[model samples]
Target: MKSLKFLIILPALFLSNLFAQATILNTIAADPESGIYLTAADYKNNQLHLAGNLSTNNKLRLNDFLGSRTLTISHKGQNHEFSKDSIYGYRDKAGNDYRLYKSYSTPYKILENGKIVIYEIKQPGHKQNGFKPLVCYYFSEGADGEIYLLSLDNLKKSFKDQPAFDSIDANFQTDYDLIKYDNYHHMFRINRVLAKL
Candidate 1:
C-alpha cells in the first residue's frame, strides 16, 4: 500500500515542477507590460522575467530627467530597487527600448538594432522661445560596444581597423544622408555599409 502511494505521488510532483518551469519561461511575454533588463544579453533575448510597470509621471520622466543612480521598479506585488549602474536598460510602456550606455546614465532610445545599433537622444537647447531641442544620434558596434557619435567622420575615425568604411562617403551625398534610414531595406544606410564589411 505504501509503495503504491509513493508511485502515485511521484508523477504528480514531476508534472507540477514542469508546469512551474514553463510559467517562469513564459513570464517574459506575460507581464504587466514593461520591465528592467539586468543585462545586454537579457535585453537582446527579450527576457523580461522581472516583469513590472514603471511609472514615469511628473518630472521623473526619462525624456526630461537626466537619470539617477537608482531606479525603483514595482514587480511581483512588491517594489524592487535596482541600480542604473548595474543594469542595461528598459522598455517603456509605449514599446520603445532605451539603453543606458556606459557612464551616460541618461537612456538613449534605440532606433535601430543589428550588427550596429543606432540610438537617438534629445539634448535641451536654449530655453528661449522657438528654440527646439537638439537631436543627437549615436551608434555602437554591437550591444556590448561603447557608444560613439553617429557621424561619418566619427565612424571613419573609430573604425580605423575596418577598411571597408573608406568607401562609405562614396555612397552618400553628406553625413546626414548617410545616417538616413532606408525604408525599403528596413535598415539604416550606415548599417548597410557595415553589412558589406
Candidate 2:
C-alpha cells in the first residue's frame, strides 16, 4: 500500500511542478539583449519555457516581413528554425513579453501586461527635403486577448464611460501640449496615464 501510494503521488507532484514552472515561464522578465532564450524542456515539450542557465550565448533571430516571419534559435552551434504558428510567445531578459499575432503574422513587443496588455509599434515617419525622418511610436491594447491599436482618438472613445476619464483626459491633454512644445517626454507621460488606467 505504501509503495502504491508513493507511485500515485509521484506523478501528481511531477505534473503540479510542471504547471508551476509553466506559469513562471509565462511571466518571465525581458532579457538585456532582447533575445528569446529557450529551456531544454521547451524544445522537448514543444512549449514556451524559461531559459534556465542555458549555456549557449547565441541570440534568437527573428526574420520579419510585412505579413510573415520566421524565428531562428541556435543551440550547440546548430540553428533551429520555427514558423510563426509554432511559437506562442517569448520573454526578454528585461522581463518584457512578446507574442505572435496571428492576424498580422508578426510578433509584437509587449509594453504593459495586466488586465489589458499593451504592445508597442514603431513606424518610420516620411522624410521631406532636407529633413530627417522621424520615428512614430504607437501602442495597442489587448481586449480579450485580441490586439487593437490604441490611438488618441480611440483612447478617448474607450475611456469615455470610465469614472477616471477626466483625469486620464487631463493627463493626455497635458502630454499633447508638451509634445507640441517639443518636450519629447510625451511618450513617458502617456505610459503614466495608461498605468493609472
Candidate 3:
C-alpha cells in the first residue's frame, strides 16, 4: 500500500512544487549557450524540454529547448499556441492542424534594433553542402513588422558563391533594443496575475 501510495504521490509532489509560473526575471536570450534549466522528467528521460526564454548578459532572447514548440504567437488577433512538441509551425485561418513552416528550429534572438536572428542547428540528416543557414527573421513595430527571411548563405555569399560558404554554423550577436523582431518579442511580455495550472 505504501509503495503504491508513493508512486501516486511522487508525480503529484513533483508537479506540485511547480504550480507557480516560471518567474524568470532573467533577460531573454535567443538561446542560452550557457545552458537551459531542465525539469526532472526531462532530465531522467533525456528529453529536450522547453526552457522558456533565455537571458544572456541582460538581454532577452526567446528560447524553447524541445526542438521548437510551445511558444505562443498572436496571429491576426487569435492566440496561436503550439500544443505538442512539433516544429514551430502555423496554418492559415483555415488549414491543417500541424505542419512545418519555414522557421529555423533553434532559439530566436530579438534584438533591440528590431533584428530577429534565428539559428538553425544542422543535425546529421540535414546539411546543405558544408554550411547551415542562420535563418534571419527581421521584424519591427514600424515599417519592418513583417517577417523578413534572410539566409546566412545569402547574406554572406551575396558578393560570393555558395561553394565558399564551407562552414558548420553561423555566429550571430544580437541585443534586446538591438534585436530584429523585438517589436514582436514584446508581444510575449506577460504582465498580469494568474495561475499557471
Candidate 4:
C-alpha cells in the first residue's frame, strides 16, 4: 500500500512541475508588444524605435526563412520589413531577446544579458539518435563583440583581464560549471564572477 502511494505521488509531482513550466511559457508568449533593437547602442539603452514600435500580432518567427530571412512589422497602416542582418535583434512576444550573432537562419536566444552575454541555439540532431536536437551555448564580451563557444578556455580568454579571473579557475572545474544557473540569484553562475569585477 505504501509503495503504491509513493508511485502515485512521484508522478503527481512530475506532472505538476511540467505544468508549471508550460504555464510560464504561455504567459510570456502572450505579451502583446514586441520591440526591435536597431543597433548595439539601442540594445544597451533599451531603445527599440529603429523601425518604430512593433505590434505582437505575428510577433517574430526567427525560424521563418522562406525568402530572404526577413522580419516584417506592421506599424500605423503600412508594413515594414527588416532583414536579419540589417537590425541588431528583437524581443519576441515571449519577451525573449534573440540575436543574429552568426547571421544564421535562426536567431540565438539570449539567456543572460549583461556585460558578458550568454546565448543559446538549437539545431536538429542526428536522425539515428532518436532525432534529439542539439543545443549549443555561446558567450560574447559585449552586445557587439564577437561570440565564442561557451567553454572554460573561451571564458578564460574572454575575461582574462578581469581581477576575478582567478576565481573562475578556482570554482569552475568543468565547462558545465561555467554555464550553471544560480536559481537563488536568478543569473548564471559565471555572472557572479562579473558581479565582483
Candidate 5:
C-alpha cells in the first residue's frame, strides 16, 4: 500500500452549505456544533474503534448518497441529465441537518500511542487517486454520531506543516483487494490509507 505523502485534507467542503446551523469547531475543539468529533476506544476483542456523532439527533449520513446510475440516452440519440447521484432528504426539519457520516477507504492505521486503529477503504472506489486520511472517532450529544476519518483533503489542511507526524502501525490483515472479487459493477474498492500523529 502507498503511504500518505501529504497531511491536510483539501477542499473538504461538500455539505457545509446544507446548514443554517453553526459549527463550533471555530470556538471549541470538541464543540458539538463545530465539525466532526473523533473519539477512540479499545474493544474487548483487542481492536480499536473510533466513533463520531452528528451534532444533532436529527442528522444525515452522506455515504448513502454517493455514486450514480447509468441513465438511458434520449430518443434524440444524446445522453441527458448527467449529474452526481444525490441522496434525498425528508420534508421534515430534521432533513435539514447536515450529515456527519460519509464513507472513505483508507488502510488500517493506528494512532500515535499504538492503542487505536481506524479502518477504512474496505472497498476500492472509496479510495481516492491522491491523498490520505486523518481519522478520529467523535462521540457527542447529537444525532451526528459517527466515526472519525478525514479525507485526503482535510488531512492535507490540518497537518500541512506540523512536525509531529504520527507513525502508521503495520499490524492487522486487510482484504486489500476485496473489490476485485466483489462481482458488482458499481462496487467501490476501499483501499487502506494509514497516517499516524
Candidate 6:
C-alpha cells in the first residue's frame, strides 16, 4: 500500500514539475483598427528582412507560419515551408522581430531591441552527472549581426584592453558568477561600456 501511494505521488509531482518548466512563446500584438487587411498589406508589400542583407519581399501570410517548428510562407496561394536551419531571422507583419542563433536549433524572439539584440536559448545541459536542461542567453551586435555565445571567455575578449578591465574580468570567472551578476543585465551594461569605447 505504501509503495503504491509513493508511485502515484511521484508521477504526479514529476508531471507538475515538467509542466512548470514548459516554454511559452510571447505573442506579438497587432492593431485591431486596421485588422486583417493591414496585416495582409504589410505582408504583401513589406519585405521580411533578415540579417546579412537578406530579405524576402514576396507576399506571404504570417498566420501560415506561427506555432510550427518550420516557417511556412504562402506565395501567390502556394505554401512553402522553410527549413529552420536556413533561416537566420524574420520580421512579422506586426513588426515583431525574431532571430536565429547559430548555436540554437530554433529561432528565439528578440526581447530587447537596440544596437544589440538579446535572445535566450534553452538547451540540454551536460548530463555526465544527470542534470536537466539549462537556459543559455546570447546577444548580437548590429555591426556584424552575428550571434555571440554568452560566456566568461567571450565577455573577457569583448572587454579586453578597455579601462577597468581587470576588475570586471576577475568577477566573472565561473558560470555561477555570471548568473549571480545577472547575465541579461550585465550584457546591456557591458554594451554601454563598449559604446563608450
Model 4 steric clash pairs: none
| Higher-scoring candidate on lDDT, 2 or 4 | 4
lDDT of 3 by residue, 43-64 (tens): 2232432322222122212335
RMSD (Å) of each candidate, 1 decimal: 13.8, 16.3, 18.9, 6.1, 24.0, 11.5
Model 5 lDDT tens row, 1-197? 12332222222343453332346443344433211212222221222112122333322122333432311212223323311122211111221112213432111222221122222322333356444443332212122223344333333333346532221113212333222222352232222322223
Q: Who wins the lDDT comparison?
A: 4
Tens-place lDDT digits, model 4, residues 122-195 = 89989787889888999898888898899989988876888657877888899888789989988998887678
Candidate 5 TM-score to native: 0.18
Using all chains and alpha carbons, the TM-scores for the candidates as numbered come to 0.70, 0.50, 0.20, 0.74, 0.18, 0.43
Return the top candidate by TM-score: 4
lDDT of 1 by residue, 81-155 (tens): 667778888876656778886664678999988767899998778868357888888888787688988887877
Better by lDDT, candidate 4 or 1? 4
**Off by more than 4 A, model 2:** 1-55, 65-68, 91-97, 103-106, 112-118, 124-134, 140-144, 174-187, 194-197
lDDT for residue 195 in candidate 2, whole number 0-100: 55
Estimate candidate 5's alpha-carbon lDDT, on a 0 to 1 scale.
0.26
Q: In candidate 6, where is summed lDDT lowest over 10 consecutive residues?
A: 31-40
Model 4 poorest ten-residue lDDT run:
50-59
Please report, as a residue range, the 10-residue window in candidate 5 with the lowest summed lDDT.
Answer: 88-97
